[model samples]
Target chain A: MSQLFQHLEPSDSHFEPDKDEVLNAIRWNADGLIPAIAQQYDSGEVLMMAWMNREALEKTLQSHRVCYWSRSRSTLWRKGESSGQVQKLKAMNLDCDGDTLLLQVDQEGPACHTGRRSCFYVRLEQNKAWVDQAPLIDPKTLYTNKP
Target chain B: MSQLFQHLEPSDSHFEPDKDEVLNAIRWNADGLIPAIAQQYDSGEVLMMAWMNREALEKTLQSHRVCYWSRSRSTLWRKGESSGQVQKLKAMNLDCDGDTLLLQVDQEGPACHTGRRSCFYVRLEQNKAWVDQAPLIDPKTLYTNKP
Candidate 1:
């Protein structure tokens, strides 16, 4: 494998470290959360970014689905639980300082609540933001009952 | 062009808007900064993530080079100014809610101060983070004058 491959193939040996040790390796901020960014696996388009607490990270490790710590809701937010725009985890990476996470995911549908394939739809051009891409689907059609 | 093409080709009509209006469209948080993620232009590998304030963002727009707000130093950190690891801006995009910015750049050298190709080098797998990459250059050699 190249020296820069971000994907980690499972270790050949049955070498499982202590779960706590694994979690402790991360340098969570004072708020006990880390910034986590999700990218579309094949296209490499960065879909969205959110925060992840230990529980959210653990859940993602177990379920192969992305979960984020919702600072606004003060709870764990599972990707696409209501909208069905789930993100299936292909790989998870910890940054060098352990303060950030990057997830390579197979996004089920539009990754943004606004129905864009990526949350980023506005291009910065001529000192302004230009709406370069239209929403793939209507935002109203995604959510059913959430207020 | 597909709806997912993140690369922003420069506009031809020269529709320039007020700089402050462009800046105000971004939802700066309480800290008056936005999370900026840089991705390798051709490879699609995310290089590094940093914070950018209005000045740093403005400087980048004017120079076509990447600059970041140094939270610790309290000044604009011109990337590669000392380390020679400059990032040439190729494209820039603002996220849906206008809270995040993504930069596609041609990285001249290792993006990490640690000399890795990217700041993200540890892959979370089999319940832990595995160092999946090696530093491309010696960190010590990159800085000769900086303390």
Candidate 2:
């Protein structure tokens, strides 16, 4: 356990849990990762979901930003390297058992790949039909010719 | 197990594992949910992460979309309902143990609340310095006076 992880319990109201405490407190699965939920700090809109390993968690804490582990290539991936949409970490919260994490970030751009502002752009009507709400951002403009 | 949950093998490549199979397959500690990673199907950008309970998992599968169990509100939530950034279900792949899920979604908007396309917007340089990559979108246009 690193000294950076030590902090107070978020539920205590008086106890402000630090990065280390939040990371170490969580019940990471055998894979050494935890589920992190990114939400709009003000509007309470969920942006997306990603995995966070110890190192990524630490980086997020130290930087006051959000970091996640990429399972596809099995590596540490920082957001916005190519797209430029960044998450500035404002506050981090842990679930009761420390199995999940909620990150309040200062987001920079759209949070989805389709060029919209969020990954969640579909809507289900009262009849249970799924409908597209908005047009996606043209990929060409978003990727900056990176392909 | 319901008929929907049957016929799902942890090793089946083509078949998207159902909620039961996903729960049974993963290495969940005591929590009923697993760590599911949401990514853009086309561009392969990482989005956000959230917990998937049995209901959320089933809902996502049934609707051919992404859903999650919100710990704070203790409810099953469909992505993009309020924000209009819906995750259209492209395909669902479970990790080896079924504890992790790779959701390839036709993302509509930004996956981050900060109006970025992906939740991963912050980047760390070689010197461990954090850098912001993604830009923020105008929320007024996105929400469009939907109070």
State the TM-score of the second chain for every model. 0.83, 0.75
Q: Name the runs in model 2 displaced over 4 angstroms.
A: A1-11, A16-22, A124-127, A145-147, B1-147
Which consecutive 10 residues in model 2 chain B have the weakest lDDT in total? B4-13
Number of clashing residue pairs, candidate 2: 53
Q: What lDDT tens digits, residue by residue, belong to model 2 across residues A1-147?
A: 222222111111232333333444557878898777676676655566678998998888777767799877698877765677778886665543455666777777676555555543323221232223232455446666331
- A1-147, model 1: which lDDT tens digit per residue? 222221222222233334455467667877999999899889988888889999999899889989999887899999888788889999987776667889999998798877778876677864465666667787788887432
Chain B, candidate 1: TM? Answer: 0.83
What clash count goes with each model?
0, 53
Model 2's i-RMS, to one decimal, reads: 12.4
Local distance difference test scores for all models:
0.77, 0.58
- Residue B70, model 1: Cα distance from true site in angstroms: 1.5
